[model samples]
Every structure is written in structure tokens, then in C-alpha cells.
Target chain A: MTRFANPKKFYNLSQKLIPILGITTLLFFAIGLYFALFHSPADYQQGESVRMMYIHVPAAWFSTLIFVFMATMSGVAFVWRHPLADLLAQEAALIGAIYTSIALITGSLWGKLAWGAYWVWDARLTSVLILLFLYIAYLALKQSMQDKPIASKMLRLLALIGLLNIPIIKGSVQWWTTLHQPPSIIRSLGISIHMSMLIPLLLMAAAFGLFFLTILLMRTQTRLLNIKTIALLKKQDQLDDPSLAA
Target chain B: MHIFSALLKHEFLLLTRNKEIFFTLLLFFGLSLFLFPFALSSDATLLKSFGPGLLWVITIFTILSSVESFYKKDNDNSLLSFYYIQKTPFILVFFTKIIAHFCLMISILMIILPLFGLFFGLELKSIVILSASLLLGTPPLITLIHFAIALTLSTQKTGMLVLVIVLPFIIPILIFGVGTVTFYETGQTLKQPFMFMAAIFLFVFAFVPWIAAYALKESARQ
Candidate 1:
């Protein structure tokens, strides 16, 4: 794993892995969508709208998962001073923010069908909304700072602070009298969701997880390339004007 | 301990030198409180109900807006470097700063809360609860704001950036602060919310200084 800490090596590895990951993500999505839409049994009560769970649950799961990943990468960057970890983290913030928004929108739409209100100031809903704000705050702080190294350090600190929210989001339903449902899949009672529904949900979750990784690598690779391009351009400029070498 | 006291005195002196800003923030707090009745109705019942929440919200805004001036003078003069050169621990500097700002916030609140009571016609008990909640709540709020200001010390437009960065974290403080008063009004036990507010204060107090010190150190590097 440390071997890929070098951006160049990571770039080469991602060049080969991207295609494979891309194909698998598409394949998993296809199978997951089939099961989710056609094969899985609908809720006796929720009926057709229960289908929205596949998209909403996976997006919600991945949104939190991506934040965890970003936080870990930021920790790595802070402790080891790994430049690649910093780049990966910076790239992940956008993807994580997008996933968060998708989860929110899809969850709200489902809420309209199931709860009759498009929005409610429930613990679960409010916590997820705060999660979205945390992501945007991370991105905004990153953009506002002019010093690259200091910005990375500060962002790592912010990410660690924001890590406090993940547990809050996970436990909001359990901790408060919320309109949102309690954890059905990961509870100690052992997977309350039926196997038919669980399979597609897990498949979709796996797909979303891989898609996140694929996009993260692609984004990081492009950023790495952009850094190299700037260096090369600076060298070319200096070579053309010898005085500029100073 | 002596170093901490000395640093605290230094911060207080600096704050006094900037009394203009000190009064301006108080004025801002009072004026914002004054506007709420106009925005809503002057109905005493209504304002009384809205009073605690509005007070907490406006306090948060005042903190956010005043954050720029709170740190600007010290940062501009590189007082952090002076402390560093004196071999003062960064965390100590952070603590003294937080203490001074907490005092500043409390003083502002002391002056404004009675006016708030008069305008909203809050009972003595309600005003006392509001004051008690603010006392417990403002430490964590100040620490978070200081952390945000330090983290964004190198950024342009830090006033707004600090708000965006800090507001998410401030949500819990706001919830528990207002919860303390509202629970009392509803005849629920106020102990739970007050305890939560204390826990938040302790958490922010213990951890944020170290993190903010790291930020201050990083900013000084440039």
C-alpha cells in the first residue's frame, strides 16, 4: 500500500485499474437496478415507492463512507506528511459533497411519499443536512486559503473536527425521537431487512463504493497531471529565458 | 500558571485598547435584538417565546462578525510570534485568548440581557435562565470561533469563511443553549440540557485549543 504513496506509481496503477473498476461498477449497477426494480419484493405498505430505497440508502451510505475515507486520508496526510494523501483528500471532498446532496434529495423525495412531508426538522434529517454543510465548509475553506501547505494542515484539522458528526448522524435516530426510521440493516439484532431486498441494496452499495473510488482516482490523477504540467511549463519558461532561472 | 495569568492580562489590555470594537459589537448585539420585534410583532407573548432562541442566534452572529477584529490586531502585529519567541506554549496563548474573549462576550451579554428582558418582557426567572445558559454556552462558542479564526488566519475574506466553517459546529451549542431556557419554560428538567452544554464546553475547551494552537503555529510558518 505504501508503494502507491508515490503519485507517479499510483497514477500508473490507476491507469490500469480505472477501466476494470469502471466496468465492474456499471455491471453491479445494472444487476442491482434489476433486482431493485423488478425482482425484490416491495413493502406491503410503501408499495412502489419502496423502490426509492435502493438509490437513497446506497447514496446515503456512500456519502458517510466517503467522508470517513476523506477523514482517514487527511489523518494520513497530517501525520506522515504524505502529499498524495492530501491530494486524494482534496479530491474526495467534491465527490463526497455530491453524494451527500444526492442522498438528501432522494431521501426527501422518498420522505414525501412515505411521511407525507417533503421536509421535517427531525434529528436524522437535520444531522444529514449538517453533514452537507460540513462538506461545503471544507471545500470553501480549502478554496479560500492561499497557502497550500497550511491549507492542507488546517483542512486536516477541520476534517478531524467534523468526524464528530459521523457518529451523531449514525445515532441521531437512536438518540432522539425522530421521524426517520432506525437502522434496519446494521443493528445488533442482525439485519432486519429481508434477504431479497438486502442483496440488491448491498450490491448497489458496493457499486457506489467502487464508483466513488474510481472517480476519486480519476480526479486525483488529473490533479497530479496538472501539477506535473505546471512544473514542466515553468521549466520551459526558465529554459527559454535564462534570467528567469533565478 | 503565572505565564497564563500574564498572558491573560496582556489579552485584556489589548482588548481594552480596542474598546471601540468592544462597544461596537455590543451595539450590534443590541440593535439586532431591537430589530426582532419589528420583524415579528411586538406582542409580548410572542417576543417572550422567541426571546431565548433569538438571543442565542444573535450572539452567534455577533461572535462571527466580531471574530475578525478579535484576532486581527494580534495577528497583524504578529503577537503570536512574540509569544513564540518568549517560548510561551501555543496552547497557553490559545487558552488566554479564549478566556479573554469569553469575558468579552459575557460582558456584552450582561449589558444586553436586561435590555432583552425589558423589550421581551421576560420574567426574572426566564432572564436568569437565559443568563445561566449563555454563561455555560459561550465558552464553547468562543473556543469554536477561535478555532475557526485560527484555522482561517491565512485566508482572505476570513470573516465570512470563518462563519461558514464554524456555523455547522455551533449548531449543537445553539440547540443546547436554547434548550436550557425552553425546557425550563415548558417545565421540563433543565439539568439535562445544562449538562449537555457543559459537556460541549469541556470537550471544546480540552481539544480545540490544541488544534487551534496547531493552526496558529502553521499560520506563523508563513
Candidate 2:
């Protein structure tokens, strides 16, 4: 865990990883999209519209999945004051919010086609909506505080708390009667989803994960440069101040 | 008589003087609800079922929108330099400001809930229940908001950010706020959410002001 404590070491590691992650994401999504759109059979129930599930389900999974990951990263930043952790967490938030926005939009579109209703206040939908709000709140807290240290500490506490909604979203179907279905392949009994469908779903999920990694590394590099720039400006201000010499 | 009137006068002036702030607060309440029609589908049955929760969420946010306004005023232009020298007990000043904000929030909700009901075609009984339900639910929420506002006082421009951070802490109040109206509308007898909210209200009112008072003093020192 502390191996990432050094920013230089972390940056060097990320520098090596960026290319590999970018290519893997590219390869996985290319094959996954092919199988998802053409090869997979329709759900015996929902028919052709079931195709949207491939995109919608994975999109939903990554959104909540990445958010919880970002919250954990926020904790690392706040607890250790690891500069790399701070950069990575900030990067994760921006990417995670985008994931949530996409999931909501896609989920709504999928609902429109499949359910005859555009939106439902079912526990599942409401819980996911709350998840989106949680992301917005995290960004807001980050913007409000000027001191980065204090902001990190504050944002971490909030992220950890907001994250409780994740379980509610995942379990809402079982806990309450909701329009959304409970997890099928990931839960209970043996693997029910056909390999043709399951393979691409898992592949897309992996691609999205790598995509997040690639973007987060790029963001951290930029943030590191910004911090160094600020430090340079502070040193310049001290050097230029003549009155303080006395 | 002199000291009491002077403090009351100060608070009254603070509450009444900010026309822009007042307008902004009202606009926030109105506009937050206004977004629903555009974002949500224009279906009546859906709105009927979802309306209470949506409106409650909006009111919670509108009150949150203004939590920083008073703190911003007290922290004017580095003039906080003089706050320490002033004779009024800072705690009293803090409580007075919080009361002023709460009054504004309650008044806004009173006027807006009915308007919301009319716009969304909710029944009169639902509106009445909503009004009472919101009143019961809001105090603890506002109390929690004020506590967080005071703690983050030293860090200016924390408004939206502060709301997010404090949001989870106030979940019970929100859940109960939703539950209160749901319980009333359903005519169910579980009756626990409202009582739970009242207990939380008492807890917040008892502890929050003291915490805010301590934070206010520390901030003024800074």
C-alpha cells in the first residue's frame, strides 16, 4: 500500500502503464461491442431490446463500482496525505461523475424502450439517482474549500458516507419491490447467463475499468504539474519580497 | 432593555437588509422545482406518486443553498477582524443568525409547498399533510445544516460543497421526512419516523448550537 507513497515512483509506474491500459481497453471494447451487437441472442423475454441490457447493465455497474473505488481513494488521500493519492482521487471523481451521468441517461433510455415508462420512483431508480447526487456533492465540497489539505479531509468523510447508497442500489430490488430486476448472473445458484452474453459483459466491464485507469493517470500527471507550478510561484514571491529581509 | 433590543435590532437588520439574498433564496426554491418538469417526463400519475419526495428534496436543497449566505455576511471583507471586539456574545449572535435562516426556510416552505401542490395537481389533503410533515422534518435538518455551516465557517465559499458533506449526516431526517408524508398519506400506523425525527430534532437543537458557538469563536480568532 505504501509503495505508492512516493509520487515520483507512482508517476513512473503510471508512465509505463498508460500505453498498456489504453491498448487493452481498446482491444476488449472492440471485441465486446462486436459480440454484444451481433453475436448474442435476444432475451427469450424482452426480445431485441434486451440488446440494450449489454450496454445499460455494464454502464450501471461501472458507475457505482467506480464511485465506491473513488471514495476509497479519497480515504487514502485524506488519511496519508499521499500527494499521489490526492491526484488519483481527484481524477477518479471526475471520471466517476461522467460514468454516473452516462448510466442514468442510458438507464432512462433503456427504461423507455423496455418498460413503457420513462422513469420509475422504484427503490432501484431512486437509489441510483441518489448516487448521482452523491457525485455532485463530492465535487461541490471539493470546490468550496480552498485549502487542499482541508478539502481532502472533508471530501473523504463525505465520500465514505455518501457511499452507503451503493449497497441500497444493489440490494433495492430484493429489499423492496422495484421495477428493476435483481442481479441474476452475479447472484444465487450457478452461472445462468450464457457464455456468449457473459463473456462480452465481463469484457466490457474490464475495458471500462482500464479506461478509467488510463484517464486517471493522465489527470494525475497534469495535477502534479499544477502543484509544482504553484510551489514555484510561492518561491518566486518570497524571493521578490525585499521588506521581509529585515 | 438596551442590550436585548440592540441584538434584536442587529439580527432583524441582517435578516431584512439583503434583498438580493432573499430573492436568490426564493428563486432557488422555485427554480429547483422548476427543473423537474423539464428533466422528468410530463406524466401526471408518476408525478403524483413521486411529487412529495421530489419537492421535499428541492426544499432541503434550497435551504442548503443559503446556509453560507449568513456566514458570508459575518465574514465580510476581513472585517471579521472587528467581530472579536464586539460586545454581543458571539454564541447569541450565532444562534440569532441560525434562527433568522430557519425562519426564512420555514416561510419559504410554507408558501412553496402549496404552490408546488397546485402546479403538480396534488390533492388538498396531501398538501396539508405535506405542510405539517415538512415542518416537523425540517428543524433537525436545518439544525444539522447550521452546525456544518458553522464548522466550515473559516473556509469561505463552501456552500454547495458543505451541503454535500453534511447530506449523509442528515439522511435520517430526509428519510423520515419522506416517511412522514408517506405514513400520513397511506394512513398507516407505524408512526415511528415522525417520532424519530422529533427526537433527532431535540438532540440537534441541544448539541448543535453549542458546537456552532465553539466553532464560531475559533473562526473569529483565526
Candidate 3:
């Protein structure tokens, strides 16, 4: 892990890994979509709209997963003062925010079909909505500050603080008796969902997870390249004006 | 221990000397409350139903508005770093600040409650419940506001940005704060919501001072 903390090393590692991740993500999406749309039986209750769950659940999972990931990276940065960890956390936030919105929109669409309302103030829905807002807040904090070191420290703290919301989002259904369904995939009484549907759901979740990793690596690479380019430009400017450099 | 007391007293004195904060916030809370009756019809049932939530929301606005005043003077004058350089125990300074601000907010809430109750036609019992919830809930809310202010202390144009960052975290407090009274009006027990508010208060009071002190340190560092 420390080895990858060096930007040059991480950049090289990601360059080799991106193609493999990209291929796997595409393959999983294809297989997942085929199984989800063609093989898995529609819910007796939800009918065709139940299919939306394949995409929705995975996106929702990744949304929360990415936040926890960002928070962990932020914690690493906070404790170790690792600049790379903060950069990874910052990059992860953009993807997390995108995934959160996707979850909300898809969840809203599914709610409209399944529950007869485009929106509800139910516990699960409301908590996830708050999750979206938290992501936006993180991104906004990252952008608002002008000083990099100060902003990085502050954003890491904010990320850690915002982590209080994750458990609430997870337990909203159970804690409040929300309109949203309780856990189905990992229950005490074995898997509640059918295996046919489960396979596709897992596949889609893998695809989404890999998709996040791929994008995170790409964004981190771009940011590092941007930093290097700026440094080189500064060095060139100094070379052009020796007196100013002195 | 003596230093802590002295610091606490000093914070209270500073707050009292800047008496305008209390009045401005009280007036702001009053004016915000005044707008609601006009905006939503004067129907007693509607006001009665909306009163708890409205008061909590307005209180949030007041808290957000007062956040700058709470830290701006010290931050602008570099008092925090001075305290840090003097080895004054940064956490103690922050904790006392939170305590003093909490006391000030409670006093403001106390004065406003009767009028808010009368304006919204709340029963005496409901007023008591609202007070209870506010007492238990406001510590976490205020600490959060201060924490948000500390985080953004070095940023430019932070008024709205602080709100954007903090409001998302305020949802649970709002839910349980309003829940305490609203649930009672509907013939439910207040114990559950009050318990949750207490839990939040305890959790926030324990951790926020440390993190907020760290934030202040970081801001002062640059």
C-alpha cells in the first residue's frame, strides 16, 4: 500500500491495471445485463420494474461503499498525512456523488412504478437523499478552499465527520419501519432473493465496483499529471528568468 | 481547573459584552416566525401542527447566522493561534466556547418560546416538550455549526457554504427534535425521541471539541 503512495509508482501500476479493469467491467456488465434482463424471472409483485433493482441496488451499494472508501482514505490521510490518500479520497468523492445520484434517480423511478409515488419521505429514501447531500457537501468543501494543504486537512475532517450518516442510511429501514424493504440478500435465514436474480445482482455489483475503481484510477492519474505539468511549467518559468529564480 | 473556569467566565463575559448577537438572533428568530403565519394561513390548526417544526427550522437558521459571530472575531484576530502558542489547551478553549454559546442560545430560546407558543397557539404541555427537545438537541446542532464554521474558517465567502455543508448532518436532529413534541401531540410517549436526542448530544459533545480544535489548529497553521 505504501509502495503505491508514491504518485509515479501508482501511476505506473494504474496504467497497467486500467485495461484489465476496463475489460472485466465491460464483460461483467454484459453478462450481468443479459442475466438480469433475459434469464432472471420478474417479480410476481413488482413485475417488469423489479428488473430495475439490478442496476439500482448495485449503484446504491457502490454509493455507500465509495463513501466508506473515501472516509477510510480520509482517515489514512488524516493520521499519516499522506497526500496521495487525500487525492484518492477527493477523486473517489466525484464518483461517489455520481453513483449516489444514480441511486436516488433509479430508486425514485422504481418507487414510482412500485409504490405509486415518485418520491416519499420514508426513512430509507430520506436517509439516502441525505447521503446524496453529504456527498455534495464534500465536493463543495473540496472546491471552496483555495489553500491545498488546509483544504485537504479540512476536507479529510469533514469526510470523517460525515461518516456518521452511513449507519443511519444502512439501518433506516429497520430502525424506522420505512416503506423500503428490509435486507433481502444477506438475511439470517439464508438468501431471501432467488439465486437466479442474485447472480445477476452480484454481477452488476461487481461491474459497478470495478467501474468505480477504473474511474478512480483514471482521475487520480489525471490529477497527478496535472500536478507534474504545473511543476514543470513553474520550473520553465524560473529558467526563463534567472534573476526571479534567485 | 481554575484556568478552565476562568476561560469559561471569560467566554461568558465576551458573549455578554457582544450583547447584540443575542438580540439580533432573537429578532431574527422572531421575524422568521412572524413570516410563517402570513405565508401559511392563520388557521390555528395549521399553525399548531406546524409550530414545532417551524420553530426548530427557524432556530437552525438563527444558529447558522450566529456561527460567524461566534468564531469570526477570534479567528480574524488570531486569538486561537495566540491561545495555542500560549499553551492554553486548545480543546478547553473550544469546549468553553461551545458551552458559552450553548448557554446563550438556550437563553434566547427561553425568551422566544412563550411568544412562539402563543403565536402558534401551542398548548402549555407541548411548550414543555418543545423546550425539552430543544435543550437536548441544540448542543449537537450548535457544536456541528461551530465545527462547520471552523472547517471553513480560512475560506472566502463562507456564509452559504457553511450551511450547504452542515444542513445535511442536521436532518436527524431535526427529525428527533421535532419528533419529541409532535409525537406527544399525537398521544405518543416522548421518551424514545428524547433518548435519541440525548444520545446525539452526548456523542457530539464528546468528539466535536477534539475535531473542532484540530480544525482551528489547521486553519491557524496556514
lDDT of 1 by residue, A91-208 (tens): 9999999999998999889778877778866666677888899999999998887436678889999998889745633443233332224433223213378899899999999989
Please tell me the interface RMSD, in Å, for model 1. 2.3
DockQ leaderboard ranking: 3, 1, 2
Off by over 4 Å in 2: A143-149, A164-192, A236-246, B1-62, B77-136, B147-175, B195-222
* DockQ list for all candidates: 0.56, 0.19, 0.59
Judged by DockQ, which candidate is best? 3
Q: Pairs clashing in candidate 2?
A: A140-B161, A141-B161
Q: Which of 1 and 2 is ahead in TM-score?
A: 1
Q: Which has the better TM-score: candidate 2, or candidate 3? A: 3
Summarize candidate 2's per-residue lDDT along A1-23 as a digit string, tens digits: 69866877777888899999889
TM-scores for all predictions: 0.92, 0.68, 0.92
- Candidate 3 chain A weakest ten by summed lDDT: A182-191
Please list the residue runs of candidate 1 whose C-alpha ends up more than 4 Å from where it truly belongs after superposition.
Answer: A168-191, A237-246, B1-6, B81-87
lDDT of each: 0.84, 0.70, 0.84
**Candidate 3 per-residue C-alpha lDDT over B1-222 given as tens digits, one digit per residue, 9 for 90 to 100:** 987998998888889898888888888988989999999999999999999999999889988888787677787788877787877877787788888888988999999999998889999999999998998888889888889988998886789889999977787788788878877888877788778778778877777779988898777766
